[model samples]
Target: MNRLLRTVFLTLVGLFIVAPLIVILVASVSTDEVLSGLPSGFTTRWLSDALANDQFQVGFAYSIRVAAIATAWAVVLGTSAAYAIHRFDVPGKSLLRAVFIAPLSLPRVVAGFCFFVLYASLVPAAYGTVGGVAFAHVLLLLPFVVSLVGAGLANLDPELEEAARDLGATPWQAFLRVTLPRIRVSMIIAAVFGFLTSFDEVDLSVFLMPADTTTLPVAIFLRLQQNQDPVTSAVSSLMIVGSLALTGLVALAARRAGLFATRKERM
Candidate 1:
């Protein structure tokens, strides 16, 4: 009975998670039958229509650019901060750590509004441009990078770094040669998280994006209010597939880095 119950629970959980994605995939490939609440014979018309739209392509390009820039900045800053906080004894370390991660606790809208006011009121020109949007995205994703990198750093071996230094390597060299290689998985994970956070960001992007430039999420959101069509479903399906692929790649990297070797390693 217990085994049967467990099987049922797992089945339900799988169904719960997969049902929406299945619906989206089906709808994305369905013709007008999607609007009729039934499975239409599969057709690629929606995907073609979505791809033919210039707005979608432009928004996707802008989103990719912004995500790449924001992720790069976040990974650089976050990795440095994580190493400093974890591998050294810094003053106000606990407070600093909390401050680094505090942004994640607040609502995104609140964060967006704060940035909006500060940038618009204080630096109007900067706030109304691509640079401003990228800056805000970095700020929004920094905490994720910091937390993930810090966690990875905490689990790293201090002895390897010490040995490198004892062998006449400078502190910087020891870090770069020994510590960095070991903690690279964390950096990669942080970069992935930062990219996703920036890519899917709506609240911050919506406020920061000027009249001329808009990210994919904001553009799609604006369109959704006016039209709920299969084209939207096609775009959403693509996003879902892209996100899942990225996640799979990250997971593979983590596994190769011995991240999931055991429960203790995971912790």
Candidate 2:
């Protein structure tokens, strides 16, 4: 009876989480009347319309470019910072860790506003450009990379590095051949998170995107502000599907790679 109850509970939770997504997916393909509850049948017109629009395509491409670049930067910087903190005996290590992870604690709006104001004051023309967006994204997502990579580093067995060193491997070679392979999962996770953060960002992108440049989230937001229709729903559903697919792939990959295991299990 207890096992049955647990299974039922999980089933309910799954339904609760997935029902909305299913509804959105259905609505994305719905006709205008179905969308408005006026009694029309399913139609793909909205999807076609969304796809045909130049703004949607441009914004999507822009978002992809920014997210890819930002994820790369975040992984590189975050991994390096985590490695330094984990490997070196630095002064005020606790304080440094706190400082490095501080960005994650700030409200998104507050951080975006702060960056916008500071950059405007220093480089007024920087706002509303790809560089500005990438910079903001890196700042916002850096903490995730640091934390995730740091966890991997913390749980790493230093004896492996020592063993490699004793085998006549140089420090660089040992890290490249041994340490990096062990932490590759953490790096992938950080990259995925960084990409998602940049792709879905709104507050910062709103301030940073130039008049000619926009991201998918920002574009969707602006469109919603002006109108709400099946077309809007279609775009939203597409974004949701894309995000979920990426997240699902990441989770599956992590599971397959044993990255989701506890430290004890990994050991």
Top-scoring candidate (TM-score): 1
Off by over 4 Å in 1: 33-36, 250-267
Residues 164-218 of candidate 1: C-alpha lDDT, one tens digit per residue:
8899999999989988877787788788878887888888778876645688888
User: What is every candidate's alpha-carbon RMSD to the true fold?
Assistant: 3.1, 3.1
Q: Tell me the tens digit of each residue's lDDT in model 2 across 74-169.
A: 899999889989998989888988988898788888888888897789987777777777888898888999999999998899899999999999
- Residue 96 error for model 2, in Å? 1.9
